[model samples]
Target: MKLRGKTCLVTGANSGIGKITAIELAKQKARVVMLCRNEEKAEKARQEIYKVSGNTDIHIILCDLSSQQQIHDAADEYRRRFTSLDILINNAGIIAGNERLETADGFELTFAVNHLAPFTLTLLLLDLLRHSEAGRIITVSSEAHRFARFDMEDLQLKHHPYSGLNAYCISKLCNIWFTRQLAALTSRSKLSVNCLHPGFVASNFGNSASAAFKALLILSQPFAISNEKGAATTLYLAGSEAPEHISGHYFKDKKIKKPSKAALNDAYAEELWEKSAALTRLELHKVSLS
Candidate 1:
């Protein structure tokens, strides 16, 4: 599919799969908007994308996904600058340290950045996306979700023992649940939403991990795929025509794959949607995709 006239927004576009995805989209002449946290890093990545793709339409909007206020501001800024959105990629995530951390909104740090931020941002931009001819929402989940122990009562992991690996796993599980619920909500529309496992690219994704996790990452570096290879599935979902009408599914290696039984629980998915809505203070009754 041609992306020349498409408008795509990618989060965490300053590095890793996000940066590669942005660069590839720009190469196809898409009007790309990169939402990043660091101005310096974003500018550097923007320049690199421009130099590589020779597409000067790249724009950057700095947003720290950990803060709900910042996410709101960024969404507003995006609306002010753009009229419609064809593709929205929620690709930013982090593995917090062993010590539990909380965001400004008082939510667990891992959950806030990996799940809530994208959940809130997507809802804010739903109208714009629905306005497009064909809208797609691609979230980068992980296979690590298979090990997640989801506690609906303690979604924030407040009562459970906190560990970086566990927190990261749960957050990824939320990503799949979010994608499924969102796809169901937009099924009657032209929008398509899906999540994927990006094959553990050797990047700085583990920089904020705990000492043990960081060491594990270091040990696995030689076996991990390169950033370019890791981004293949994301770019496939973004640019290919194969998945235009496919929604509420998981992908790995650019093909549909069955997620864990937990991810397939419709009841759990609906509950998660409600919980996320409450956390984001979003009035679900007012949200209309049709």
Candidate 2:
């Protein structure tokens, strides 16, 4: 009951890493509000989590990450309903096939959900988090971020052929970039923002992926870790007190790890932040480095 009076919101809390994270948080007695795309799955997971954790404070809000408008509206409604936010876990992501895809906001699907949605939603809920005694933001990035190349000219990959890996890597890279920048922005405050790579887990993560990727996932099932193990780092980051002061870092297996050179590029992070603000048409507050 460490988090008995606290409130936490988790995106994509219906399954995989998100589901486990939510359940653990609920076990710790936090008010877990799950933002999911499907009401049926969300309700089912909510009931199961409540049953297992013996915590009935689980609530659900419907929001499709692929749509920016829904994100904005969902944030608004959430803020109106909740008084404080202690933890935010951006765990939803996608790896579309070789074909190119775009969101309702006209941005690449991978970039929109994996990066832009978090960017927008986090900023929207910053005030609520700041009001809490110990605010934490945990984004589920991937180790594949090492393969990303940040090109200002082709952020959406409009100039090149569509490769799911390329887009997925770029989105994960952006997750690190956003986390670093956000941690810097809140350095003077009690809020801690960070991202992590949950080791390759045997889950439904690649269900929507390309045929080749799906086959590879099936072949590597035995080698991949379980979803419970993958959710461990996230739970530690979200619920434990050891990392209270640690911010703006990457993690794998619950320990901080160095990101790639590109992921560490401050200039690229700033540029991407500005570009994301423009694309989302959001007027953001200026962040100070002091």
Global Cα RMSD, each model: 0.8, 1.7
lDDT of 2 by residue, 128-239 (tens): 8887788889999999999876577688898887788789999999999999988887889988888999999977798878899899989999899988999999888887
Q: Which regions in candidate 1 have their CA more than 4 angstroms from the true location?
A: none
Q: Tens digits of per-residue lDDT for model 1 on 13-38?
A: 99999999999999999999999999
Prediction 2 global C-alpha lDDT? 0.88
Candidate lDDT (C-alpha), each: 0.92, 0.88
Model 2, stretches more than 4 Å misplaced?
286-290
TM-score of 2: 0.96
Output the lDDT of residue 238, model 2.
Answer: 84
**Cα-based RMSD of candidate 2:** 1.7
